[model samples]
Target chain A: MENKLKRKMLWLDAWDIEEQEAWFSHMSLQGWKLIGISKWMAEFEKCEPQKVNYRCDVFKLNDKSENNRIEFYKQSGWEHIATRGFIQVFRDMKGDNSLEIHTDPIEQAATLSILKQDITKRGILTLLLSVITLMLIVGAHQIDPVGNYLNDKFIETIVLIIAYMSISITMVNGMIHMSKLMKRLKSGSLLEHEKSYHRKIKRNKVVGITVIFILSLWVLTVFLNLMNSLQEDRFPAIPKTELPIVQMADFIDDFTYIDEEGLSYFKENSSFLVPRQYQLEQMVEVPGETWEDNSDIYSPSISSFGYEVRSEWLAKKFVQDLKEKHTYYAENYVKVPESKFDELWLSQGNFNAAFIARKHNKVYRVLYYGKGSIDEIIERALAKAER
Target chain B: MANDQRAPMTEAMYYVLLALYNPLHGYAVMDEVKKVSNGRIIMGPGTLYGILKRMQQENFIVLDELDGRRKIYHITENGREALKHEHQRLTCMVDDGKPLLGNGDSNGK
Candidate 1:
């Protein structure tokens, strides 16, 4: 038996945590009996030379009693030992930590190759992120493919909730880890002359990340509010009549005719046509003078009143357009024959569409129709369609 | 460099500090400390690593990571000064305590 005083434990500093664990596991795999870890410096310091007990903060490995033991300190040219036996294999499997900047050409070349490989991997990840960002930006216009309804809104809300929760969890976890690392790096209470440089670095990184997150949140809120307000403001007031000189040629090309029933059904089923208020114009084109009272027809005085009685006219025109146009939303309009049109218009008191209704003592009926920014959507959709 | 009051510290800490005082690697320092102490008060690999790490945080040591697993270390001027003080204090303590304990000295005073 070897003298008890002659045996020693080997201590290792692996390249990184994985290499360290691998080495420990490998030793155990080779039929070495596992020993318990030494939690503190004191336990390790109390180690008796050539003792069977081997200890470390991580896993502890002990060779079989018959195998010769070498004290880590007693071993000659340990750098060579570490570089040769288990350590060499460990470094090969992981990475070499022994290569200095002033290393010989061969080692330096190998290090450069590893660095190049890492850079390539990073480049690929960056490219993937950029492509994902670009796709989101380009696809922002139609972010909602499903019909717009309370359900779609509910789903969107859920998605936002999930995204927010994930981000919060990740940020909190990261912050906790960072704080722990900082604590480990800092020594005891600071002294007057002691500059805790690492603490300062940690604090700066945390503050910077937090500030960026806050700023992004603020910016996103403001941008969404602005878009919402713009949408609200752009829609014209309802019950107006001037028939805003829309080119008949453009309307004919852009729209197909639909029956009133079909229009109402489409509007009811479509998520997009939420019950929104609107402005309208009804043109009163009189047939060539069998009108006995022709003066009111051309009067500049009644121009502002065109919006007053527009609902009845709007209802009439809305139904007429359904018959004449294949547009989807129809329930927004209700048809009234020329007989009840005047009464319907005159009965409503002084509202924009109602005001115009009082003056029309018309002999013939008019049409009611749906309103939209179809012209605007037409321009955008046409470009995409072309592309 | 020789006259700093914070110099002349405990032999063990001083030698430990000095071994790492150069750009010597960590394991190399462990072996050297073993030789310097003649295997008495032998520095364990783990203890040396711990001290080296602690000293780094204290700004007394810096990792010379020009190599990977080898992790060479060097002492800062502050470390040198601290080691000197520790050496002085520990030596004084040992000298003062020996006679008092009636172990190694003739004069109890």
Candidate 2:
């Protein structure tokens, strides 16, 4: 009486093409008629679930004889329901054997050989992609100074990995299952357990929940940011004058921003590229020079310029990463025993100091080298950061 | 796998050739073979198609007729000779087995 849509994880292997047929027939009979099939899920529409017989055959698609085959099946009283690539699904309206698609085990084996070949090709392609994607992730980690990702771009990195690996794993699973099915069929041990399909864990719900969870997290982050920006006293929007606050001129004395064309690429891949101001000759920096940039894309309302909100665990990692890659710096920074704030101040000389303080989960990184006391300079930078 | 020096044909292959002594298409060959072997030799579409193609390639069978989408094949002179040779080999084996099977429980002494 009404139309309804439902998604299901149809878990039938190569050996269970017959089971797939019977399963489809059962589905239609139960009124959950299959309307579409994708790589991951089967789409069904509700109607009057009537008793029917379904059959799936692996026919060579894009051949001249395909029409003849379809005609022959039509004459035999089977209605072609859908064509998924090479898989032809046909329904017997009366739930009777007007004709059989595969009549014998030998014929079934030949039919399965085609599927075996197709999946083998897919498996090889998936293996190549999985390896390449994994290598890229690892390679990205190596170039990244703070570890696997920038302190803020961690979610994006995880998403990239998951998207690639899910496809790879599905391809691999198909290849392996097809291989096992072919081996058993070839050996004449047709282990067709009648109800083995029912025991398979339905993962459609899990996939649905995961997608919802990720979307909700993204939405929550955006919503929180919107709320934060509206707070006048707390996390206010950045003023137009502060748009170019963190310029290359503050970090180095002579470097250009690699031209405007390359600037975007530079910011996106800053972890991999050093786009500092190159010293042409003797260099003089501007007074009150500080590099203040927030990398978090979700929150435009950065509460303070120098302070970065990160997972609490990353505070220790930030300091450790700095020490481990000390060879990249001009001078080694020794840890100060005592400090005015709950901060670890690492100083190269009396004039130069790096103040790292962890407040709750936020980390404040203050870099300075001047004639005035380090504490006073830190205070000045903090005041400007709040402003 | 060798030509001219043919290995003994399989049961399905042998009966298929026998069934195709008269010109017949795929389904007819399947039906005739089953009848001749008294329901023992059952051939499906895929198996018959595979066997017929292999036999045609080996020059053991030739396409006698191309009826619309159906193909009818007939055994060649080479095919008849191969079948006769296999029959003789099978008869010799059966004749050899008659003595051992006839004197039951003799314990080979």
Candidate 3:
């Protein structure tokens, strides 16, 4: 005879002893006898449809007397089916009159003490992890809130927070259920067998599916990041044109675009929160300019980064962020109230002049290293942004 | 004071101790406990195992030998002392109750 097997993914709390036993019994009645069990799955073999009793007991797996204990149960006519962590499942036919594994409720509660202690330890560890995750998020925001928003780290942080909170919630929920089970057993009530598990199964299904969905989302985010890193063009062969970013030619006349190795390039990237990002680093020089004439090798270089955000509000905030970032090099940023763009802030520095501007749903920053009025650079940047 | 931790022995623990008087293995202890209790206390394998392990930890019992996978245990002196005290305590309680309940034979009717 050919033996058939089936596997099921189940999410039953270990402390929910009655529900686990009842569920196994229910499966047996449906002609699927449990053959194996692990943390997240149960393996079943096809058998004749018959009523049977399933019982779960907790015993330390590493105990020296574990084999003796199992042998004792077998002598009493209970067949050990599977062991998952400290939990051991046993089965017997309904009318066999086999000795119950735990006749005394209080004694059974003694066996559950080990499980309770294990859960308490896990609960404490999980709580610590959750607190650390929360602190990381708060620290990241406190250090550079605006920078995180602009660099697309805000979404990743939110996802990490959700993942930790979900795990914490699940752990706390399991602790609560275990406490209830312990209370009942301590009160000398035998754990009910063959109870209805429909509600518990439904609830577990929802929780399991939600956990899987969150895990998949996190994995997808990480995979996409890896792929983007591999596909990013670090050094372009030729200069890109028609880009919606400020270029050196827009501000300088009769300048040669510097195509030096590893000095200048155009790059693009995107994220879920903000799509359509562009970074440009272009160095330009006059026809007669040379390093001998000017100590600086790369003169009149334009390094600009821009983003076409999904909303005007985001662009407004991004412009402020750009200004704050540039304030490190330039002592202060003076607002250009009557600019061609929606908003603009020009850096107040002699060596490296910069301007941050926003128009509708677009935000950009341009840094110039030359001896020219920053107003011309700002005007050209605004013109390009408006176009 | 040495037996303070095991001063108040549970019914199951007391019966298990009594069963270990003859150096019985795990399953044999369960059978003996049921027989000595006149079939009133059908000790489950789980309960028997827990009591045996705890007794061994408290030095109330010692593993005498290992017959295949069966562990035969014998009661220690500490176990005997605890059982003796528990028996005295139970006897005192029954004696005290006899005055109010007519020796537990009149059925209070």
The parts of candidate 1 lying over 4 Å away from their true place are: A1-154, A178-387, B1-15, B20-27, B37-81, B92-109
Leading candidate by lDDT:
3
User: What TM-score, to 2 decimals, does candidate 3 have?
Assistant: 0.87
User: Candidate 2, residues A183-282: lDDT per residue as tens digits?
Assistant: 7666765435233344333453454457557767766865775685576343122232422123223333443222222112111112211211111111
Best by TM-score: 3
Candidate 1 chain A: worst-modelled 10 consecutive residues by lDDT: A262-271
- Measured on C-alpha atoms, candidate 2 has an lDDT of 0.57
Tell me the TM-score of each prediction against the true structure: 0.31, 0.66, 0.87
Better of 1 and 2 by TM-score: 2
Per-residue CA lDDT of model 3 for A1-387, tens digit only, reads: 248999998767776788889999899899999999977899999998878888998987678766577777877778889988889999874435458889888888888988988888898899998999799887977567555655567766776787788788878887887788889988979888877778878887897788678778878977987897798767764354567787776766677666678667888877654688888887776776555446655467778888888889877877776667557644477887797788877775666777788889888788777777778777777777778
Model 2: colliding residue pairs: A31-A49, A255-A278
CA RMSD per model (angstroms): 19.3, 10.0, 3.5
In order, the B-chain TM-scores come to 0.68, 0.83, 0.87
